[model samples]
Target: MDDKIILAEESLKRNGFQVKIFNNSEEAKKSLLESITTDESVAFGGSMTLSQLEIYDDFKNRGNEIYWHWKGEDRKKELAEAYKSKVYITSTNALTLDGKLVNMDGVANRVSSMFYGHERVYIIVGKNKISKDYDDARERIKNIAAPKNAKRLNINTPCKFTGKCNDCDSPDRICNVEVIIHRNPTGANINIYLIDEDLGY
Candidate 1:
């Protein structure tokens, strides 16, 4: 095991979070599918990592009530149901070695759901998303994660062209709100699944 993964897992456990480790994304996806039941409703955050997993169709086919603004025709309705779903699935932008989870959002529905309104929260992270410290984690979010997301969403931001954060005042900026979770929220059973390979930006 990588030293950073070990440290992050131990630190997360100490912070009252359940940590699961996998060698790759396939294992993580398989475990998540097993852990969540069709009887329970599932919601998705606006995360590229979640998109990579591509489990939405499977969940829907198995008769799990699904809520994801990215997939549903009525985004507003999906976002509302996601806020109060039985399970919330998402990924963090960055996870520090000391166990801090960091993320920035444009709309904030995804970030807010992590703190409350769900009985269970599953955060799947790739090893490459882990940083040495909090500052580095935040930097990774601004420089790497935010820029890539801007390009994907085709948001007219300066960073979209530069491939770096310009801290612009554009109306379409995607990183308006940032959150750093130092400890697990009391309202949900938070589970952190760490994969060894790089998965998302």
Candidate 2:
């Protein structure tokens, strides 16, 4: 493993999160499959990273009940089902080298589930998402992830056209809620899986 990854894993471990590093997404996916049982109820937030990894179908093929608003016909019902699920999986916008998970969301469902309700939370991060510190991480989210995501979602925010954050008050702004997870939430078994490749915005 690279030194940065080692340092990150150690730091996350110190914060009481189960940390795993993979050389690629395939290895990470296999590890994820083995970690959860077939009958478990799995839920997910809106994550392009997980979509890139094709995890939803994998879990479904393995007989795990999935609740993802992106894949469901009914968004509200899916969100509710996801909240009640045993395992929640998602990706972070930025991960600090000092072991903090940072994310910006519009609806806040994804960030909300990371801290509570779920029995286990799996946060899969690509190496490109890692930042030197919290300030750098937040910047990455605002200037990089949020803008790119807004464009991807076709949101009529200034960032979507400018390729940068204007901190706009646009109704379609995706940067409504921001969450920073410094440590594992009480009674939650949180896992941080760091993948080598760049996978998401």
Candidate 3:
């Protein structure tokens, strides 16, 4: 196993989180499905892994209500409702070898929901999304993740043209809100499934 990945798993384990490392996405899916079945009221935040797994459909099919922030949706209403809702699925932009969850969002839904709303949270990560350190993780989002997301969503942010974070104040700035998950809540629960293959952006 890669030393960094090993470190990440160890750090998360020490924090009282259940860490599962899989060889690929298929294994991740199987494990994830089993985990979800054991829990009640599964909810999902925005995530490329969920999109790759098409896991939201699975949750909905199984009668689990997912809470998430959508692009171009009414932010005020979504934020209000999410405050009290429990979230089960969410994606972190980058995970450092030391098990730091780093992400940037326009509305901060993804980060806040992970830390607060959910009674039990499950974060799915791809090895490609792992970084050497916190600074590298954040930089990856600012340069690679943000620009690619902007292009994919056709956002009109300055970084779309510059191919790097320009710290734009545009309404389309997806990196406006940033959050780091350093530790799981004392009494709350969080689990991380690390997939060896690339899963999401």
- Tens-digit lDDT string for candidate 1 (1-201): 677888999999998899999988889889989999989999999888888888888899989999999999998888888887899999999999888899899999988888788889999998889999999998898899998999998989998999889888999999889998999977568999999888779
Clashing pairs in 3: none
- CA error at residue 186 for candidate 2, angstroms: 1.7
- Show where candidate 1 strays beyond 4 Å: none
lDDT for predicted candidate 2 compared with the true structure: 0.90
Off by over 4 Å in 2: none
Query: What is the model-wide C-alpha lDDT for candidate 3?
Result: 0.77
TM-score result, candidate 3: 0.87
| Model 1 lDDT at residue 163 | 88
Q: Tens digits of per-residue lDDT for model 2 on 1-201?
A: 666777788888988899999999999999999999998999998998999999999999878999999999999999998999999999999888788898899999999998799889999988888889999998898889988888888979998888889989998988889888889878888999998888898
Sorted on TM-score, highest at the top, how do the candidates line up? 2, 1, 3
What would the TM-scores of all predictions be?
A: 0.97, 0.97, 0.87
Evaluated with lDDT, which candidate comes out highest?
A: 2
Give the TM-score (vs. native) of candidate 2. 0.97
The sequence of per-residue lDDT tens digits that candidate 3 reaches over residues 97-188 is 77788899876767877777667788988888899889899889999889988988898998888889898889888886788878777777
TM-score of 1: 0.97
